[model samples]
Target: MTESDLTSNFPQQSGLPGEKRTDELGMRILKAAQTMFVRDGVDAVSMHKVAKTVGIGQGTLYRRYPNKGSLCMSLMQTKFDCFAEAINEYLRDAANATVFERLSRVVSSLIRFSENDLDWLKAILQSGTLKDAKANIFESPPFLFIRDTVQRLLEEAAAKRELVPLDPAFASVLITSSMTPELMFYLFDSGYTPERIAERYVETFLAPLFAGAGRI
Candidate 1:
């Protein structure tokens, strides 16, 4: 799907106090952060720098986002919302598409989004504040959404005898784990293009699950 298609599906929220103003400020902060992140490396874009760039006080920034990790989470939430919408739309309109085709599209879309915003993704994943000892990455909204969606798709494919009999839950975990942010970055840095990575992943990992259904 196009970037415009993904963005146009982002949900419009309301009901909170000063919701409009809050969203406005949040957008301003994200824009300032994105600019700094692109000009400098993610490591160099401090919360102080972001606040100063947006012409806001440190306290005001902290009130909205207690740390860089919080800001990054907000940024990721926006991207994930768009992503989830894209997946839903594809599933709705592509009823005639094979389960493997639908699954491949989801994987391609995710990889493209990551490559397009690698810097922000790296920053978010590496942020010190996000390193909570008790936190489960699988429990995060984005991860859960992806895992559940993939599992559902795999289950449907298996039901139709399009895929070999297997545990959808385990397969979904395997798929998502292979596409973690760190692994994707490493592959990119090691001279693998996103398209090549996606192709290889489907060939080596997903294609085999289809038994004799052939390559994706």
Candidate 2:
């Protein structure tokens, strides 16, 4: 996949609430699945195992999540919400910061999330069911939020004469292209610390824009 394609933008799926009892049961099933996946690895966990672990019938588990992909998507939804919230919070707090500084902070946050959730994300991407579901990661809500945030930053910088004129959408894509899991993992494995990766990312992709500004 192209770098842009690899950058997923899936929306968070919300659980339906039929009744209090059903909601509680669904929570139990989801918790069991998460626990098992973390303890035994995603590839080793199955619907049957999760049902047995949660003491629920296989049919019941299937009713909630027809396949591993559905369950994985639900699991990731919560994480993505938190991730999005963190970025929002950071931007709010850094309102007075320079565009470069704000961009650096966002990059740093993304690197931290990638470092912490690499395995979980890998499992979701490797799931055949998710692929078959044809969920466009680029259209996902969290991704869209990140993309829009970056675009806004780029536009702001250009408006403020801190960056040369450019298409914000294209610039946002270029910035996020470096934040993909594959590239991030390669950099991590190559002995680049997360901080170092963030620094280099800013230096390579952003510094020149600011340095040359109108000249560029």
lDDT of 2 at 31: 69
Where's the lowest-lDDT run of ten residues in candidate 2? 1-10
Which runs in model 2 stand beyond 4 Å of their true positions?
1-19, 38-45, 133-135, 214-216
- Superposed by TM-score, candidate 1 places the C-alpha of residue 60 at a distance from the truth, in angstroms, of 2.0
Q: lDDT per residue, candidate 1, 1-216, as tens digits?
A: 343443444455565779877877777887677567667877788999999999999999999887787787776677778778778998899989989988988888888878987877777666665578226877888788888889999999988888877899998988886788888889999999999988888778878998575535
Worst 10 residues of 1 by lDDT: 1-10
Error of 1 at 216 (Å): 6.2
> In terms of lDDT, which candidate is strongest?
1
lDDT (10s digit) by residue, model 2, range 127-200? 65556544586776766777888999888888898886678899887677657777877888899988898888
What is the C-alpha local distance difference test score of each model?
0.80, 0.75
